[model samples]
Target: MQFHLSFPISPLVPGIQHNQQLMLMGSCFAEEVGAQLTDHRFNTIINPNGILFNPLSITRALTSYLDGKLYTESDLFQHQDIWHSWQHHSRFSGLSKEAVLQQINQSQTTAIKAVEKLDWLIITLGSAHAYTLKENSQIVGNCHKVPASNFDKRLLTVEEIVTSLDNVMHRLFFRNRKVNILYTVSPVRYVRDGVVENNLSKAILLQAVHHLVNKFNRLYYFPAYELVIDDLRDYRFYKEDLVHPNEQAIQYVWEHVTKYCISPDSQELIKEIAEIRKAAAHKPFNPESEKHILFLKRYEDKVRKLMILYPQIDFQPLLLSFIR
Candidate 1:
């Protein structure tokens, strides 16, 4: 006698709702997606590790990149105002430049904590290769500094990637019973790496991540790399560097993501968001109302729209107090 067995295939859902909190991490590409979601009023918590500079700093850096002045350390440091604000924040009490540099030598504890609250984890693996610091033997996200002689780009094996992911997932599951994981490989070519080895490194990462996605039941892989290479292979979709995806490419990626990950209620919220965004885009700022009155009106308009869509979601009264 022969027996037939059946397995359940999970239904693919659309993009998450506006009310769902999202936590984004991994590479710089994830930062771009996080910023877009934030602009659409999604509750996006970026870079849980807090080692990287905050969102405002990222915006300033992107502007510098656009202006063709982001090629040097001096240019990057020109956006110090964003970091200065963090210094005054109570959470950063003991955080100094030296301390942060030292902390980078240790495993990322803050990133581990941030992943704990995430309903959906969006990780974009930039490279399988990483530079390890001499002092603490910890993996550095980017090798922007540290004498070239002291560092070597060590490419992680599939096992290493799986182990690292399992470690993070273990912590997350211990904190919360269930969590969904999404992985993507960044499509940006490492042009500055100055070696064929760079492309090989990305290929290895792509292969390894794909393997993990297939093996894991809960993890999902998004075709970000394919979308760039296959769907938007045209050079026009890229920035001046001919590497990073331009705004158009990013929009295309987001639309594809929305099709698979978003829910019905979230889709409705996004439609409302589009209307709000259009209204805000067309409205002129009235400067003469005794303390930036037009800003208040805009805030009120946004609040009204949010209330109309999510009347049950209670917003803090203090949230409105800041508008005036």
Candidate 2:
């Protein structure tokens, strides 16, 4: 009784344990998956340059770290009483240029360090559509609410997308030869670009990812786009805006990721940690009841024993919570 087709994911590398470091880039979906990885206490960092979608923008951010480029006053433009860089997400903008540079530079320092030790680099491509600011003819990561007339919007060709990913792969392989790469196309619809354009953009991204995966032996695709659009093809799977995957859809895709990508040992520990997480978040009606206190003590013991087994997992917060 197969109601839906499932994507065949590649075998996860043998050494990908909970303690292994991972670097996540591209799209909000990357952030979504990274959040769960972080929740389970996987050593992971998400979109150090923020949620960039287009391939060129993501590569630019990665390469910037390699080149040791930090945003300066010259790189920022004063707009609406704030300083913003076209290379960064709007969240990084600040009232003062120095403040923005401080945040951006700090994050780059962290990302550069993370990149040096990454065991896995997960990339979730969102779209092939890119916007180059007409003023400088540069591929800007975000427009920061500037008028559309100020930017030239264009769809990236398959070759163009491949070149960007190729650059990323070359840099990563040069720096960290042991890092395995996982590529996924985000299922989030770009309805703002029109439905036809959205599909065309995804087609390009799909082709580009396929080309890169074929070119590099350590690279693989997870079929996250197929998971939502094909496996759970229902309007109910979408959020109210009909653009993003709802909780159920996200969970389904994450479950597939766990089954296919995460190691069995880490998966088992994640289940145990989920229970401990559940108990940690639980709040009793009686704030100081003996029953609640005893429950907290049991959770504390459970955490200490598990921490002894897997020292990588963070049991500090739960310990402090129970203590408080």
Candidate 3:
């Protein structure tokens, strides 16, 4: 007997293959999926501007690259003896202004390079709520721990989100005509916003995605939000913070994403790569035992065979691990 309801998913006629390039942005959930794709040897660029939650910020990041925007010392501010940008995640913060701008410019350049060959672009919208800097009236991608009084908090209307998405799509296609776009609403709960507000925020994002999906022929929506709310409707699926989905819930959502979004041949290849990774990561109890050596030989053989079958799959890093 079926225990829980599953979200209805229509498979993309032919989903992403291993050889294609993927770019994912918006929210930490996008990072999680991108990490999985990377682990399986898919070429993917994830969150070049770091984890941007809202559509406006994500669009800003995309436009920054396409428009060739560069960061300068003026774009950064001293925060707790370090330099940081409101447009970037705190991970880019550094002790020197030159370092911060260097990193930010490097990331923007990397994104522009990646966009040229981008095959599938997946964007995850986490929230519709945004913070606008009071001084310049600019919506900051991140607040950078600035005082609350310096910013005006607001939730973007469905129209605004749709417009941001439309501009992003238009710019993306203008640069790359062959790219397929996918969008998803992150399942991470925004408890800090209060329950009702959080629901409203998510609803706005969902509505915007639906509108965009219907408008664009190549755009697709993945029901990651619905899977968490309807399928894994239990507190056990969340972390101690009761906000982010735990490993179990993420795995559940990932299975659905794989089934609906990955090509059949690539699915089998992912399985093989998973086995290779497991073998590579195995720790031997007897470091010099003959049996262990035999296992290593078999492991190397597996890697060799897999590489011969899929020449694009690189095993050099793992192979070099045994050299010294």
Candidate 4:
């Protein structure tokens, strides 16, 4: 007898390679996958303008990168003595405007370069709901703890979402014709928007993504939302807030990603890297012991050997961690 519904995922053609430049954009779910790819030594950039939820905000951020837009004082606004960009996540907020602008501009520089050479672009849309400041009628990526009364909330239509994303794809393909896009609907639930409303929001995102994926040969969709909401279908997989996926749930999706999205030839390399990572994370019972010293030396030698074997990978961080 079967316990849960587990479906097969067809492997993506021309799957992700370790040497290729990849970018994971969109919600917090992107952050989770990006972190895993980073740990496995994949050359990847995650969320340049931070984690954007709706398609409009994501479109805005991507276009900014394509334009190499620079953030200035006029682009920023202060609330509670902290400066923030309506187009950026709270992570980019700073006490001083100069500090905030410096970080934002630096991210834009890196993001534009990343976009130009991007081999794979992974986008995870979180929701269709968007907030626009009532005063200026401008859509915001984040509220930055602003009063809800100051903004008007609306759920984006499927056509609107598709049009927004279509514009992004047109510009992106023009700059990097070789780029392949993978779309995923984030599984994180926004209960603040009401349960029925959240479902409706996700449905809109899914419809828009599939519509675009069908229209573009290089576009693909991953059933991340279905994997969590339908396959797992358990409360235990959720965090305390019942909104985010817990560690186990994230690992489950990541396992599927490795099996379907990444190149099979790189599996052995991933396993070897995981082992080295685990060894690096080990905490010794006796830090001064000869056995611990030998343990460190062994991993250091392993790192050096691996580095020689895969010259494209940067193992300096792991090597340094093993060194001392």
Top lDDT model: 4
Off by over 4 Å in 3: 321-324
Count of backbone clashes, every candidate in sequence: 4, 0, 0, 0
lDDT of 1: 0.58
If both were scored by TM-score, which would come out higher, candidate 1 or candidate 4?
A: 4
Query: Residues 202-268, candidate 1, lDDT per residue (tens digit)?
Result: 7777776777778766678787877877776788989999878999989888876666677777766
**Clashing residue pairs in candidate 4, if any?**
none
Candidate that would win on TM-score: 4
Model 3: per-residue Cα lDDT over 7-46, one tens digit each: 5798986699988988999999899888888888888888
Q: How close is candidate 2 to the true structure, as a TM-score?
A: 0.96
Per-candidate Cα lDDT values, in order, are: 0.58, 0.88, 0.88, 0.93
Q: Write the per-residue lDDT of candidate 2 for residues 1-324, one digit (tens) a residue.
A: 988776666766663689889989999999999998988888888888888999999999989877777667788898889888888898889898899999988988888877867889899999999999887799999888988999999999999888877987798889987889989999999999999999999999998999888888898888889989998999899999999999999999888888888899988988988898889899799979999989989988888888798787677876776774
Q: Candidate 2: lDDT of 45?
A: 84
* Residue lDDT tens for model 4, 1-324: 999898877789988989899999999999999999999999988998899999999999999989988888999999999999999999999998999999999988999888989999999999899999999989999999999999999999999999989998999999998999999999999999999999999999999999999999999988889999999999999999999999999999998888889898777789889999999999999988999999999999999999998899999999998886
RMSD of each: 11.2, 1.4, 1.4, 1.0
- Looking at model 4, residue 27 earns an lDDT score of 95
**Cα displacement (Å) at residue 29, model 3:** 0.9
* Residue 171's lDDT in candidate 1: 53
Prediction 2 global C-alpha lDDT:
0.88
Error of 2 at 302 (Å): 1.3
